[model samples]
Target: MSVVAVVLTALMFVLLGPVAAHAGAGPRDTGSQPVDSYANAIRQSVWVDTGLDGDRDGKTDRVAADIIRPSEPAAAGRQVPVIMDASPYYSCCGRGNESQVKTYDQSGNPVGFPLYYDNYFVPRGYAVVLVDLAGTDRSDGCVDVGGASDITSAKAVIDWLNGRATAYTTRTGSTTAQAGWSNGSVGMIGKSWDGTVANGVAATGVEGLKTIVDISGISSWYDYYFAQGAALYDGGPDELASEVESSGAQSHCSAEEQALRDGAPRNGDWTSAWQDRDYYANASKVKASVFVAQGMQDLNVRTKNFGQWWNALAANGVQRKIWLSQTGHVDPFDYRRSDWVDTLHQWFDHYLMGVDNGVQSQPMADIERTPDHWSTDPVWPAPGTAATQVGLKASGTNGLGSLSAGAPPASGTERYTDNPAQDEDDWAAQADQATASKVSFTTGTLASDLRLSGGGTVTLTATPTTTSAHLSAVLVDLGPATIRNYEDGAEGITTLNTRSCWGDSTSGDSACYLDTAADTENVQQTVFSRGWADLGHYDPSLHGVSLTPGKPYTITIQLASTDHVVPAGHRLALIVAGTDNGLIVAPSTKPTISVDLSRSSADLPLVGGLPALAHALRGGSGHHHPTATTPAATPSRGPAAALPTSQAARLR
Candidate 1:
C-alpha cells in the first residue's frame, strides 16, 4: 500500500474502532467523518412555518428549531446529513436524566441541547437539530396533543430541509434562512414523546427523511389511553395537553384542550381526531427505514404500541430493527449505555450518511433476556415460534385450575366477581386465596426452560351477569428472581452518582451524563404480561355494544408483547379478574363473570410450540409442597358463594 493508504487505513481504525461488533462496508467509504475539537461547532435557531394555524392566530403555526453543526463544513461548503429530534417537552418537563433544557445565548443561538445527540453526532459530520413542537417552548400554536398540529409541525422541518417549506431566522422576522449545509438526508430520533413525534413525521412519507430511531414511543394515541374500549385513565389527552402547554398559551389553547376532552370521552370510544394522531394508520406511507427500541414491561406507553407498529412495518415491507429491553419506560442510553451509543452511531452512519456499515445485515432484534444480559436474534418472536393454546382445567390439587395442553376444557366453569380495589400487585400476591373476586390457573413446574417470544392473547368465552364488564388477565412467573422493578419506578432505571462522557464538551454543555443501572429487586414472582378488555366491546372495535345481561360473549384480551422465560422448576400462573385498580378506570357496574373452562384458553407465542411446552410440563406433573421460593397457599378471604347469582346460572 502507498503512504496515503497507510494514513487512511490508520484513520479508519480510529474512527470506526471496535464497536459492539459493528463493521463498516469495507474501506471504500465516503462522506464526512468524525473530527477532533468538534466542540467548536456552529449553533443557531430558526422558525419553521407549518401550514396549520391550530391556535387560530390568523397566521401559520411556526415551530422553534435549534441547530448545531460542525465547523469544518462551512455554511456554503460540502453538505452533511442531519439528525433531528422534535419534542413538545423541551420547555415543560425538559429531557434526559438531568432534565437538561435548551440553553440559548443573547443572539438566540442554541448553547446546549438536552441530550448527547448533538455532542456525539455533530463531530461525526452530522448536524443535530432540536425542534420544539408547536405550542410548546418558543413555538407558535396551541398544543395539539398528538394531533395534526403536533405531527405537521415536526413534518414542516423535514419539508424545510428538503426545500419544500420556509424557515425564518427570527420568529417575527421576514428574512428567510436556508439549510445550505444540508445534503437533504435526515434521521429522526428521541425517547418517549420526542420519539413519538419521529414516528408521526415518518408516517407523513416526507422527503429528506432517511431513517428514524424511536425509543419507547407511542404509535397511536388511542392505544396509549384506551385498550379495547377500556379507559386507562380517568381523564385523557386533555390532561396531557394542559401539562405540556406553553406558559402564556393556555387561553389560546383552551378550545383545543376542550376538543381533546370531547374527542376522547371517558366511555372509551375512538374518534376521528384519534385517527389523525395514529401513525400506524399511515405506516404504509412510511418511506424511511425504522429503528425501534421499547421496554417489554413499559406500562406507560405499553408494549402494544410497538407490537402494532411492528406489524404494520412488516406488512409494508419497511426496513426495521428493534431492541426489546427487560426494563420499563426508559431510553436505551440509560439502560444499554455504551452499546446504545455505538449501535446508534453505526445506524445513523448507515442510513443517513449512506455508509453500508453492515447494520442492515445484522440481527434485526436485540432483546435483553435477563437483567443487563442481552441476546441477538435474526428476527423477533424468534423465527420458529408459533401460537399454542393451553386449556384451563379445574383439576389441580390447588383450588386454582390447571393449564394443560390439548383440547379446551370440556366441562367445567369458573366464576369471579369484579373487585376494583385489588390490583395486579394484590392479586399476584394472593394467588392461593379463594376469593370470589378473582380466579387463577397454574401450570406445573417446567422440567425445561420454556420461552415466550412475542405477543399473544388471553381469550375468554364467558357470560357476564351485568350489561357491561371490564376484565383483566395477568401472566406471572411463580419463581423467585431479581428483576427490573419497572412496576413502581416510572423510568425503570436509576441514575447513579458516577458520570460518563461520550463526546467533546463545550462551555455551556458537556457530553457527559450520570450513569444508570437497571433498578432491580428480588421478587417471589414477576407479572410479565397483562391485557384488558371490555366484554361489551367483543368485536374489539372502538364502539361498545349493549349486550343482554346474561349473554355469553367471546372476548379476546390482547396481551402486551413480551420475551420471557419460565425456568425449569418454576411454575406459570394465569390470573383472571376484573378492573385492574389504579391502572385503568373501572366499569360503572362491577359484575361477576362466569367463564367456560373448556372453551377459554390463552393463545401463547411459545418459542418451540407444543414440544417446548410439553417438555416444560414434564417430570410427573411437578406438583408437591410449596418450594422455598413459591408462596405457601394462603387462606381464602371470602366464600365463593358471596358473589351475586342470577337466574341465568352466572355469578355476578
Candidate 2:
C-alpha cells in the first residue's frame, strides 16, 4: 500500500470507528459490475485557502469543499481521479432536478451530497468534490459575480487536489490536510452557473483538469446580461450579485457589488468588468476537451453563449463535442436521463480513469430535431453550411414584404413606430394590419426542405427619430409542428411526482429523483431564434453614440444560434420591430424608424446552399407531416415559466 493513502485510510478508520460491510448492489456472481459501497463512502469536508481576502477581513478567504470517495481499504495504495461540481448555488438555491442541497452533521462532515454525481461515481472508484463558491455557503468571502473571486474560488480546490494549494481541517484552524489520495486527474461537470465555472477554469489552462461537460453554460457575462449595447433586462449586475451573495457580505461585499455597477454601465457598452470575466477570450489557453450542450430555444443562457464560445474554441483547435436540443434551459439528466448517464460515465472513465472507451469515436453532435426525435451529426452546423443573404423587399402595402434571395434591385423605404405593447406574436398574427409596430417579411410557399444550422445576423439601414432605439429581430417558422412547450415550463420539462432511482442509496442521501416529461404544444408558428441591439451603439466600437434625427446608420443584430429544418409548404418570416415587449429594455423614446428595404437583409446559415432553397420552392410537399395544425397557444412568451422559484440560477 502507498504510505500516504495507507495513513489516510487508517485515519478514516480511526474517525469512523467501525463500519458495516456490503457488496456493490446486484445479483451475486453474475457479472463484473462496478462496486460502490454507498453507506461506507468517506464523506468529509475541507476548507481550501483561496489566497484572497475578498471580504476584506484581513484573512485569506476559504471555500468549503464537501468530498465523498470510496472507502475500500483494500485499495489503500490506489489513488483516484476526481469529478467536481463547484457553484455559488450550493448554499443559496439547489442542484439537479429535485433542487437537492447539501446537508452536514454537527462535526461539519457532509452527510448529504446533492445530485447523483457522488452517489454514482464514488462507488465506481471516483472522488466527488462539491464546492461552495467562496462567497456563499460556509465559505468566507463576498460575491464578485463572475469576477476573479468566482473563478479563483473553484480553481484553488483543483490546485489543492494537485498539491499546488493548501487546505485546512477547519476554517480557522492551523492543522493542514493533504490530498494524498488524488491522482491529479480531474473532470469538471455542472449545469448553468456550475458548468460555467468549469469553462472558466478550463480556460485557465489548469493542468489537472482533463475535460469539462458544460450544459447550458455561459461564455461571457456581458453577453448574457446584455447584448451588444442593449440591456436584456431591467436589472443588472448589482441585482444578480445580491442574489448569490452570502449574508456575511453585507459588511464588505457592498463595495464589490457597487464596483460591478460602475464597471459595466447600464448603457450596455463593453467594459473591463466584463472583460475580466470573459473565458472565451482565453479559450486558446484551454487544454481540456469540452462537451457542450444547450437548447436551440434556450432564452435564459441563450444559444449565442454556446455559438460564440464554440467557434472560438474550434478556431483555436481545442477538442470539443456538442448537443443542440429543441428544448429550453434544462439539464439533460432531466430529459435524456439514461443516455446522459451512460455517455457521461464513459466520458469520465475515458478522460479521468484513462479507460480505453470509444467515447471520442462517437458522433460529434447529438441534435434534437424535434421533441423526442434525435439524430447525430458528424459535424455540427452540418457540413457545407454557409451564410446566405436574403433581401427584405418592401411590398409597399399591407405592412408586409417579400424575403427573396440576394439584394433588392430597387430602393424603397418602410417605417414603423416603437410599440411596447406589441410582441412577436402580435407581429406574426397581425402582419397585414397597419399597426406600424413591426415590419414583416416572408418567403414564398412550396419551397423545399430548408435546413438551417448555426447563428444568423440581421442588418438594417435606417434612421431613428429619437435619441435612443432598440432593434429586435426574430426568425419564425410559419408551419405546424408539435414541439416542446418551453413557454409552459421554466426549462421545458415538467417535473412529475413519480420517482426513479439510479446508483446506490443511503439514509441521508439517495440517488432517487422525481421523473420528468417534456411539456409539448402543437403550434402553427414558433420563434426559433431572436436577437437585439441598441441602435444608439451603432458605431463599430459599440460605445454609445448620439443619433442625428434623420441620419441613416447601418447596424447588425446577432441572432442566437439554432438548428432547424423548415419543411416544404411552410414559409419562413423575418420580423423587425422596436422595444420587444417583455424581453429587452425599451427604447428611450418610441422611435418612428425608416427602414431602407434596399439595404436591409437577413443572413441565414443554411445547409446545401442556394440550390437547396431553389429545389424546395420548385414544388413538392414537405418531407414530414405535422402533429397538429392549430395556432400557437402562447406566442409572445418564452420557455421559462415552469422553473420552480427556488431553482432559478437566472444567469449561467
Candidate 3:
C-alpha cells in the first residue's frame, strides 16, 4: 500500500478500535463511565417549541435546553437514558450548593454550567440536560407562575427527547434538531422551584418520564402563598411571576403579569387559576415512580406541601420513597453530603439505567431525628401509630390550663383577645398564666419519652365575638435543649469561606463547594408544629360562613406534620391563639374568643397505648405498663371525669 493509504488506515484504526472493543457494554456492566475521560462527549443547546402563546405574541414559546452527554456511546451506535433538571432560576437565582448559574459564550452557547449533575452524571454514561423554563433565562414567553405554560414547556422537552416533539437550533426555528442519542427513558431531578417543575410534568403523565426526585417542592401554588384562605407572604402570584422572569422591560409582559394576579386574588382563596396549578389534584395521572425529600420544619415551602402530595401519591398507588428531615428548606447534598452522593448515584443507576441495585427493596422512608442523626423506617409515621386525644382543662385562676389524659373541666371557659402583632416568639415569651392574647395548656414532665410521629389536630369548640377571625394553633416542646436552627439556613448549614471538594472537576465546572457546618442553637423552648385557619373558612376553603353573634363553632386546625421525640422530663404544651404575626395575614378586627374546656381537646398521634396513659393519669400513678385493651372509665369528679361520655365515645 502507498504511504498516504497506510496513514488513512492508521487513523481509522485509532477511531474504530475502542468502539469495537466495548460494543456490547451496558450501563449495568460498567456501573458508571470513567469521570476523567470525555474524548467521546457532546455539548450543545437546543430550543424546544412548547406549542403555546403564553404572552399572546401570536407565536409559540420555546424552552431553552443545555445538554452534555457521552458522545462515545452515540458514536458507537449506542443509546443512553437522560437525567434532566428543568429550572427557572438558572439565570436569575442560579442553583445547587454554591448557587452557580449558567454562563454563555459570545456566540450564546453555554460555556459554563451550574451544579454537579453534569460533571458527575455526564461521565457516568448518562446524558445530563439542564433546561431553562419558559419565560426565564434565555427561553421565550412570559412567566405564568406554575400555570399551563410553565408545565407544558418542560414536558415538551421530554417529548422531544423521545422523538415525539419538534426542536430547533434557534428560537425562530431555523434548523431542526433531534435527540438521536436518547433511549427515551428520562429521570427528572431538582430542588425547590426546579423540583416543582418535575412534579408538574410528571402529573401530565408524559410517556417518557420514568421517575422524579422532588426536593422541597410545592404541590399547590395556592398553598405556597396562602394557608386556609390567609395570605402567608407579602406578594401574591403576580409579584412572584414578575420577579422570576428574565430581567427586561416590564411592559413586555405586563398583560401576562396581571393575569397571574387576577388568578390568585388578594383574598387568598382557591380559584380556577389555582386549580390549573394544583399537582395534587392531578397526581392520578402520574406514571412515574417518585422520590421526595422535604424538611419537616421547613417554613418556606412548608411541610403540608409534601404531606398532601405523598398522601395523594399513595392513594393513587404510585411508587414512592421519601426523606423527611428536621431542617428547613434544604438539599440533601448539604445535609447528608457523601451519603447523598452515593445514594443518588445508586438511585439514578437503578431508575435511569435499569440497574438492579436493591434500592427499591430498602426502607421506603428515612427521617432525621436531629442534626446529623437519621433513622430508616418501612413507612412514614411508622404505620401502627394511633391518634390519642389529650384533654385541656382549666388549671388555676390564671388563663393557663393543663393537658392530661383525664377529662376537661365542665362549664369552665378560657377567653383571649386576638393580637395580630404577636409572633411565635412573642407568644411563647409571655407568662403562660398571664397572657390574655392567647391560652396556654401544658402537660407535666413526661415520665417516658413520648414520640409524636404524625400531624396533630387541635379541635376547639369556641365562640368568636366577630364574624371572622384567624386562629393559630402551635405545638411547643418546653425544655432546655440544643437543636438545629433550620430557620437560619438550609439544613442549618452555616457557609464558610473554606471550600471542600466532593466530586471530580471539569474545565467548565468545579466539584468543590464552600464548606458548611450545622447551625445549632440553645433554647428553652421550640415550636414543634403550627397550623392556621381563618374562622370564616372553617367549613371549606373559599366558601366562608358568617358567624352568629353568640353561636359556638367547632373548628379543627390540622398542624403541620412532624416526627419528633418529646424526651423524658420534657413538657408538651399546646397554645391556642388568634393570628401568627410572622406566618399569616391576620384579620383586621380584633375578636374575643371563648374556648369551652369541657368540649375542646388536642388529638395527638402517639405510638403507645392511650388507655393505659389515661388509666395512669386517673390513678395518679407514675409510669405504669400499658394494657392491650381499652381501660374501663372509672366514676370520678372534677377534671378526671369531666369529659362527657358522648364526647369520649366520639373520640374513640
Candidate 4:
C-alpha cells in the first residue's frame, strides 16, 4: 500500500477503537448539566500557528479564532466538547438565513457571533469556536483556496484544542495559552463554505474530530467550478481566489493567487492541486460520523457534491444521515425549521456528549416531496428502486421527439447546431417540433404518479461536424407547476418586516430573528435536472482525447440526483443541446452534431416497478404507437412484444 494509505489505515484503527461498543450511548455523567439550562459563558479570542509561511514572513502563519464556552464547566473542573465553525466569511459575507456578521469589541474580543450556534450551544454546555480561515479576516497568511494550507490551518485548531499544538492571545505574542477546559472531542458544523472546510478537515485523518454536519457543502472544488471538462463560469481559479481573499493590499498574496490560477487552468482538467482539494478522494481517511443536509435543486454547490460524497462515505462504511430537499441552494433551517433544530440537538447530543438518544435507530434519510411536505425512508434512493432505460425516438420534423420503451427504428436521426447564446430555459422553451438549436423528447401522460428517486444516466451516440462540442442534457417536467422560487431567494430566505423569537436571548445576541417568507414561482414547465460533457475530454478528467470528425462516439453523462413526483398526466421530457448558456461556458466553435436515435436513451431510477407500468402505459407493446398518418416504425432489435396487462397492473 502507498505510504499515505498505510498511515490513514493505521489512523483509522486508532480512532475507531472502542467506539463501536457504545455506538449510540452518551458519555459517563461527570456532573453534566441539562441541555436546556443556561450558563454564564466566557468569550475570548486566540491565534494558533498552522505551521505554514505562505507570505514568507520567516514564521508559521497564525489563524484567528473566536471562542465561547460555559464558565461553570471550568469552575467545576469539567471539560466540555467543542463545536467549531472555521470559515472565510465570518467577517465579510456573514452567515445564516439573516446574513449576520461577527461583531467585535474595541479590545479585539468577539462580542457578537453570526448565526444561532454560539447563542444556542454555548448555554447548552458546549464550546463554540468561530475561526477565520488563513488569509481571510484577521488570520495571517495567503488564502490558498481549498489547498493544503486551507485544510492544514483548520486542522491546527483541532490540534490545539486537543493539546497537541500551541496558541497565543496575539499572533506574535510571547505568552502562550491552551484549551484547558476542553475534553479534546470536537464536532465541526457549518453551511456552505464553512461546512466545506469541515469536510476537508475531517478527511485529513485528524484525531479528536468526533462528528461533522455538512450542509450544502462542496466535496470537490474541481466539480464545483467545472463540469465534464467545461468551466462553469468565465474566470477560473484566480478570479475565485481574489474574490474570497481578504479586502486589503492585493500584492501581499499575488503570488499565491497566481499559483491557484496556474494549478486550475481553464481547460477543466484535474491536477494534483484539485486532487488535494477533493475530500471525496480522501474519504477513506474520514473517521467521524457525518450528517449532510442539501437541496436537490441547489445550483450553486449542485446536488452531485452531496450525492457523490454520500456514496463514497457509504462505500467506506462510514455512518451517515441526510436531508434532501426540493428548494434550490437552501439550508434545512429555512426549509424545515423546528424539526431541523430538534434533530440537530439530538445528533450533537449523541455524537459529542455520547448521550444514548436513540438517534441512530431513526430513519437515515428524510426527503422532501414538495415545499412543505416530506417523507422518511430507511435509506436514500430506497432499497427496491430499479433503473429503467427510457429510449428516445425521433418524432416531428421540428426537433420534437418521443420517449419510447423500445429502441428506435434503423433509419432515423436528429441534428442540431451548437448555439452559444442559448441558455437552458431557451432550449427547454422550444416546444415547437422544429427548433434547430436542440432536440426534445416527451413521454406520454402517466397512468399514475411516478416517483423518480435517484441519480440518472444519459447515453447517446453522436457524430460532431467539428472535432469538439459541448453537450448538455436536461431532464424536464412538462406540465404547469408552481415551485419554490430559488433563483430569486438565492439565500433561501427573505427577511420580512416582522420578527419572532425561538429560544432565550442574551445581551450580545438574540434568539429572535426577522420572519422569513417563502418565495414561489409559477411556470409552464420546469427543468428538473441537467448534466454536461465536453466531447474532447471523453477519455479522463485530466486528459483529452481528440474526437475524429464524423466518427460515431458514445458518451454517457450522469445526471444530478433527485426525488420528485411526476403526477399523472404530466409528461417526462429530455432535451439534448450543445450549450447551457447560464450554467456553463459555451464552446468557442459551434459544431453541428447528429445523434443516432437507435442508440440514445436515458436510464432513470424510479420507485417500485414503475418501469413495467411505463411499458404498459405506452401501448402494451414495447414499441412506438402508430400515428394516424404514419405506420409504426420497426424496432431495430426485434418485433414489438406485449406484456400481460394484469402483470403490469400487479407490478404497478
RMSD of each: 7.0, 6.1, 9.4, 11.7
List, residue by residue over 182-234, the lDDT tens digit for candidate 2: 88999999988888889899989988999999998889988877877878766
Error at 562, model 4, angstroms: 1.5
Q: Rate the local accuracy (lDDT) of all candidates.
A: 0.80, 0.80, 0.76, 0.75
lDDT of 3 at 432: 47
| Cα TM-score per model | 0.90, 0.91, 0.88, 0.87
For model 3 the local lDDT of residue 299 reads 72
Clashing pairs in 4: 25-354, 26-354, 26-355, 26-356, 27-354, 298-329, 398-433, 398-434
Clash count for each candidate, listed in order shown: 2, 11, 1, 8
Q: What residue runs in model 2 are displaced by over 4 Å at the alpha carbon?
A: 1-33, 73-75, 431-434, 619-649
Q: How would you encode candidate 4's per-residue C-alpha lDDT over 1-652 as one tens digit per residue?
A: 9999999998976554323322333343222233333335788889998999887768789998899887766675778889998887776666776767788889877788777777667666788898888888888888787787778778999999999998999878967878998998999988877788889998987999999999988899888877878776666656655665676515588888888888888887778888888998789999999999987767677777887898888889888998987776666777677798778877887888887667877899998766667889898777667787777877646466777664545348998888777766665555434567788777777666777777888888889988778898988776787777665534334557876665556777777777665666676667778888887766555455667889987888878877777777676778899977767778867899899887788888777755654643553222122332322222221000111112111011
Give the C-alpha lDDT of model 1. 0.80
RMSD of 2: 6.1
Instruction: Estimate, for each residue in 1-652, the C-alpha lDDT of model 1 and write its tens digit.
Output: 9999999999886545522122235553432345624567888899999988888889998888998887765632667789999987787777886878888788777887989988788877788899888888899998777888888888899889888899999998899999888889999998878888899989999988999999988899888888898887555777777777788677688889889888888777767878888999899999999999998877777788998898899899999999999877678889999999988988898888767667788899998877899999998768879998887877433336667765553677888889887678667666655566777787877788888987888888879988889999989888888887676543458879999998878889899999988888788877888898878888855688876888788888999888888888788888999988766779989898988876788888899898888878877354322421334434322211222122101100
Q: Order the candidates by TM-score, highest first.
A: 2, 1, 3, 4
Question: Whose TM-score is higher: candidate 3's or candidate 4's?
Answer: 3
What is candidate 3's local distance difference test score? 0.76
Q: Model 1: how large is the Cα RMSD against the reference?
A: 7.0
Report the Cα lDDT for residue 206, model 4: 97
